[model samples]
Target: MEQVQQRLTELGFSTGGVDGGYGRKTVEAVQAFQATYQLEITGQVDESTWGMLFGSHEGQDIAADDPADAPTADRLVELCLHQVNDRYVLGTQADHNNPDEDEFDCAELISWACARLGVEFPSYSVSQIDASHHAGLGLSVSDAATTRGALLFRRAGHNGSKYNHVAISLGTGEETIEAMDSKHGVAVGEIGHRFTDGGYIPGIQYH
Candidate 1:
């Protein structure tokens, strides 16, 4: 619910600050979003509404001047960085587990961020890396480090092992934003190590 509110707020509607309660304000916002996008007139978020809200951008790269507002990678950066001091937990994606606030695992951070852009990245690193390879979204570590909003990961032990973590490229090649751990939580940190797998959001028109 907070994810929906935060996302709605990011896209220009005001959900009154991700307060988690699905109040009248939220209903009005969702309804406005649906109306703007030419969706059915249900104020409630349904399957089609969820898709349009979070996964409809297949080919639209640049943000449209019209009703369809597909966010860019830089926009993604702004969203992630906005949650800098948020919590971190093992399995929560966005505000799924915590309604009053947001919490994330490494990949879930990317998953949640990508959701705002209409890209559905998997909730974990192993599948995410595999899907990227199949979709040709995989990037070399060096490329990923330099590509703002690219997801970076490091794998070990074997081919089938999941990458232990993931981080987002900050575009400078020297740093990244990450939901690091329980102790460190989400923070902007130096990209000091090598990565074994990585990818970028498909619809985010990278320059």
Candidate 2:
């Protein structure tokens, strides 16, 4: 079951948890996968579904999964919101499996949200934003106000990395959630003018 969950995640379907358990979340992910491939939506990993997922069928014409408008993006935002009051801790990754361990940093919060849904993400702002864009898993939104679920980013120095820090936009033009360094652990704040760039996060949304 854990393997299935991981496979689904790799295909851009979020199972919500990677625990080796066949619960409703797993079923939902399976259903989405099946539906995507025009297979029977049994919500169960039967022979055909398994074949589609693992690439066992030779004559199939398949493309990589695009999570541009997946519903899971909103959920990822919700997961970040749940950590609103947590303390900021640098070089620490948020533990999705343990609610009690809530320490996080700017990039760590995004990493944790992805981990909760079995999605893979880097632990630093620069890497997470840049690497994904290079891999075609992330899309930039430099025009128009960032829509709901868009990723917000900023840089400190004039010649600094555009992804110096990261935040989750509330879809609203102003609101966002992020671990604003040592001073503000995890807090609900505005995506001030400093946040000059935006992105559609992988496994989240496109814009």
Candidate 3:
């Protein structure tokens, strides 16, 4: 476990000191890592994550002799994402919510996913928009046109203040993202139509 924590820390995850125990800090760090990689925020170390921390190295060693190509961070993130399901939880960093337990939100999910993808992001919903500003990565309708990796957004309530919720594009116009909500374990939703606000993030493309 200490090794795991060390590996995660070396990968840019704030593990709060490399300890063998899995504490809240470790969970937070793992969630942060998962967010960057666009993976499901489960907070629990699983097979996919192990592969991410270790398998990639093995793969590189095998490919070392081959002058063809090498694995990329984006590819690793995508692999991790596919290994997870879409579910949501509350109060837990594994779920997209205010770490303070204030509200269940999607930005947590986005932030976690982005972390796993090696992208730095703010941990709030509104901040997500601001972070994407001028970056051309804010959610948009045209994102639905693409069938592969795309970000999804949903508008809710009457006032703009009520508008909340965001998700990753699952290539089928479906609002499915690796979420962690209390009701659902880790699943996807239909953005706006079934859940609430819906749109896609541009510029920061995921493949």
lDDT of 1 by residue, 1-207 (tens): 998887777765555568889876577566545544545545698987788778865223232542355557766665565555467798875653332346788888777777766776688877777777788888988889888778787776534644377788876676677787787566666777656767876666566
TM-score per model over all chains: 0.61, 0.58, 0.45
Q: 2 or 3, which is superior by lDDT?
A: 2
Worst 10 residues of 1 by lDDT: 58-67
All models: lDDT? 0.68, 0.66, 0.50
RMSD of each: 12.7, 12.7, 9.9
Off by over 4 Å in 1: 1-68, 96-101, 157-163
lDDT of 3 at 156: 57
Tens-digit per-residue lDDT, 1-207, candidate 3: 898888877765556688699976576556545544434556777887677677754223212342332233233234323323333444345432322222234666666555554556676665665555546544444454233445444445634535455555544454354443555433444444443323334333444
Ranking by lDDT: 1, 2, 3
- Itemize residue pairs with steric clashes in candidate 1: none
Candidate 3 structure lDDT: 0.50
Q: Which candidate number has the best TM-score?
A: 1
What would the TM-score be for candidate 3 when compared with the true structure? Answer: 0.45
Q: Residue-wise lDDT of candidate 2 within 1-207, one digit each (tens)?
A: 888999877665567679999876577567545544546656788989888877666224322343543447656665665565467888786776774556898998888888776777788888876865676645344331346556777755634543378887655565566787676566656655666566666665442
Q: What is the lDDT of residue 110 in candidate 2?
A: 87
